[model samples]
Target chain A: MATVVAVIASTHHPFYYRASTSTGPDRPPFADEWVRKITAFRETLTRARPDVLVMVGSDHFHQLWLDNMPQFLVGKAPFYDANWYNEEREFGLPRMKLRGQEDLSAHVLRAGLDAGFDLAFSNELRIDHSITCPIITLRPDADLPVVPVYTNIFAPPLPQPKRFVQLGQAIRQIVESWPSDLRVAIVGTGHLSLELGGPRQFGPHGPDPEFDRRAVEWIANGDLDGCLAEVTLDSLHAPGNATHGFMDFMLMMGVAGAGAKADYVDSLDLFHTMEAYFTWYPNGVPEVGA
Target chain B: MSRYLVDKFLYTVDRDPELVERYREDPRGTVAWWESERANDLLNCHSGEASTWLRFADDERDALSTHDYVRLFELGAHPFLTLTLFIAMFERDYEEPLGFQKQYAERLSGFTLPYPDIAT
Candidate 1:
C-alpha cells in the first residue's frame, strides 16, 4: 500500500508569485517575506519526495466559466500546467508539463463515487495559476507527476463546507488503498476573505483579520468540523468576502483528515487577501510552537 | 507613464476617493502633487490614453464623477473604459495580495518582485 507522507495547504494568490517581479514600493520587505515562506514550503516538499503530488485548487474564471462548471472535477490525463498572469515572466515559472497518475486518478474518482459523492472527471485538464503558482515553487524546472482536482468556489449552487472535508477523507482512503508503494503528498491552494469582482474587490482595504485568525486556529487545533461549523457562507460572504475560499480550505482538511496533526501553521495578509499556510506530519504536529 | 496611466488614474480616482475632492479643489495643483513635470504635459507625452481621463477631472464634479469615475471605464460613448476597469481589477489587486512570500524568497534565495522607477 502507498504511504501518504505529507498533507500541505496554502491560500495561494497570483500576487504571491508576481510579487517576485514587481518594482519599488510594491516589492516591500514584507512582500519579500511572503515569497520566502513559499520557498521554505517548497523546500519541505522536495524533502518529502512523494512520487505523486495531488493538487486541488479553485478556478478563477479561467478554464471554467459561468456557462459550465463542476463542484468537484479530477484529472485523468497524464499531465497539466500552471500558466497564466505572467507566470513565466514574473514568477520565474518555466512552461513545463507535470505528470498525472492515471491509474491513481481513476481510483480517486471511483472512490469518491463509491463513497456516495458526486464526482466529475476530466481527461484534458489544463491548469491555471491556482495549480501552477505553487508548482513553480515546488518543482520549477521539470516534471513532477501530479493529479489535478478542481473545485467550484467561484460559482453559485455550491455544496456545503462539510462536503469538501468529506471529499478529502475519500481522497485519503483512495490513496491508502492504492496497490503501488508510491508516496503521495496533497497540495491544497486558495484562501478566503477577498472579493474577486465585488464593489471592494480592488479596494485598498484589509480583510476581516479576526475571521481569518479564527479559521486558522480551528485548522491548527485539528478541528475541521469546528472550522466548518464556524465558517458559514454568510460568514464568508461579507463586504470583503473574507472567507470566500473556505471550500478550498475545507477540501484540504478533508484530504488531510482530522487524525493528522498540523506540524506547522501560520497566517499573513497582503492588503487585499489574508492567507493561511499549514503542513501536516503523520508522526505528530511537532512541538515547535508557531 | 502610459504603463501606469490607466492604473494610476483608476487608482487615484477610485482607490482614494479623497483624491477626488483634492482634484476638484485644485486640478493642476493636485496633478502636480501626484505627478511631477506639469500634469497635462506628462499626460500628452507619456500618458496619452489617460489624457482625457484627466480632462474629465476638470468638469463640474457631478458630470466628471458621473461619466468618468463612477461609470467604470467606458470608451467614446463615454469611452470603452468599463472593460478597462474590469481588466485593471483583474490584473492587479485593488487592495493587493499581500503576504510573506518574499520573506521566504529572501531567505531561500534573495527573491523580490521586479522593480522600476516610480515615486512611492
Candidate 2:
C-alpha cells in the first residue's frame, strides 16, 4: 500500500513566481516573514521527496469560465501547462510543462465514480497559476508527475465546502490502496480571503479580516464545521468574488482529515488577499533524521 | 495603446477607488484627458464589433462593467490583478496541445498581483 507522506496547502498567487524587482538584494516582493514561510514549506517538500503529487485547484474564470465549466474535473493526460505572461514571458519564465500521473489518475477517477461522484475526466487539461506556482516554488522540477483536480467556486452555486472535504477523503483511500511503495503529496493551492471589483473593491478594507483570523484557526485545528459556517458565498465575496480561492483549503482540510498533524502553520496578510500556508503529516509528523 | 487602458484601468481600480470614483463622476472628461493611441479602443470591443466610445464614455464604470466589457473587452477580472493587459486582452497560439487556457484563463493564471515589492 502507498503512504500519504504529506498534505500541504498554499497560495498559488502569481506574484510568488516573479523574482522581486526590489534593489534591496535581500528583500523579496513578499514580506521577509512570508519568504521564510515559503522557504520552510519548500524544505518540507524537499524532505518528503514525493514520487507522485495530487493538486486541487480551480481556474480563474480564465479557462474554466461560465462557458463550459465543470463542477469536478480530473486530469488523465501525461502532461499539463501554464503560459508565461508579457514581461514574465519576455524576462523568460518560459511556458512551463509539468508531467502527469496516468496510472494514479486513472485509479482516483475510478474511485470517484465508485464513490458516486459524477466527475468529469479530461485528457486535454491545461492548468494555470493555481497549479503552476506551487510546483515552481516548492517542487522546482518541472517534470514532477501530478494529478490535477479542478474545482468550481469562482461562480455561484459552488460545491459545498463539505463536498470538497469528502473528495479529500476519497482521494486518500484511493492513494492508500495503490499497489506501489509511492510517497505521495496532496497540495491544495489558492487564497484564504480576497475581493476584487466588488464593494470593498480594494485596500484599507478588504478580505473580511475577522473571518480570515478564525478560518485559519479552524483549518489549523482541523475544524470542518467552523469552516463550513464561515465559507458562505456572500462572505467569501461581498466586495470582491476572489473569496472563492479559499475552496482549495476546504478540500485540503478534508484531505488532512482527523489524523493529520500540523508540522507548520503561517499566514501572510498581503494587500488584496490574506495568504496562508500549512503543512500536515496525515498519519504523523516525519522524523527529523529520516 | 488599447492594452494600456485595460492594464492601467485595472491597476487603478484595484488600488485607487478614488480614481474609480473620479471615472464615475466624469467618464468622458477623465478618459479623454488621458493621452494614448488606443484610448478609445474599448468601445470597439463590444462583442468584437466597433461601437462608439461615447456609448460607454458617459456612464463611467457602468458602461465598462457591462457583460460585454467583462466578457469581450477586458476578458475578465484576472487582468485587473496584473500589469499584463496584453495577456488579458492579447494572446499567441503557442501553448497548443498542453492544456492551453480555453480562451480567457491564460490571462487569469499568469497575472502577477502588483506586489508591494514592485511599485504599486
Best by DockQ: 2
Cα lDDT listed for each candidate: 0.60, 0.63
Top TM-score model: 2
Candidate 2 per-residue lDDT over residues B26-95, each given as its tens digit: 5545555542333334431255543244222333234344322333223333323432332333234445
i-RMS values of the candidates, in order?
Answer: 16.5, 14.8
Chain A TM-score compared with the true chain A, each model in order: 0.88, 0.89
Per-residue lDDT for B43-74 in model 1, tens only?
21344433333323333222233423322211
Candidate 2, position A265, lDDT: 85
Model 1 chain A weakest lDDT span, ten residues long: A196-205
Give model 1's DockQ, 2 decimals: 0.03
TM-score of each: 0.67, 0.70
Model 2: lDDT equals: 0.63
For model 2, the TM-score of its B chain against the native B chain is 0.31
Residue A247's lDDT in candidate 2: 71
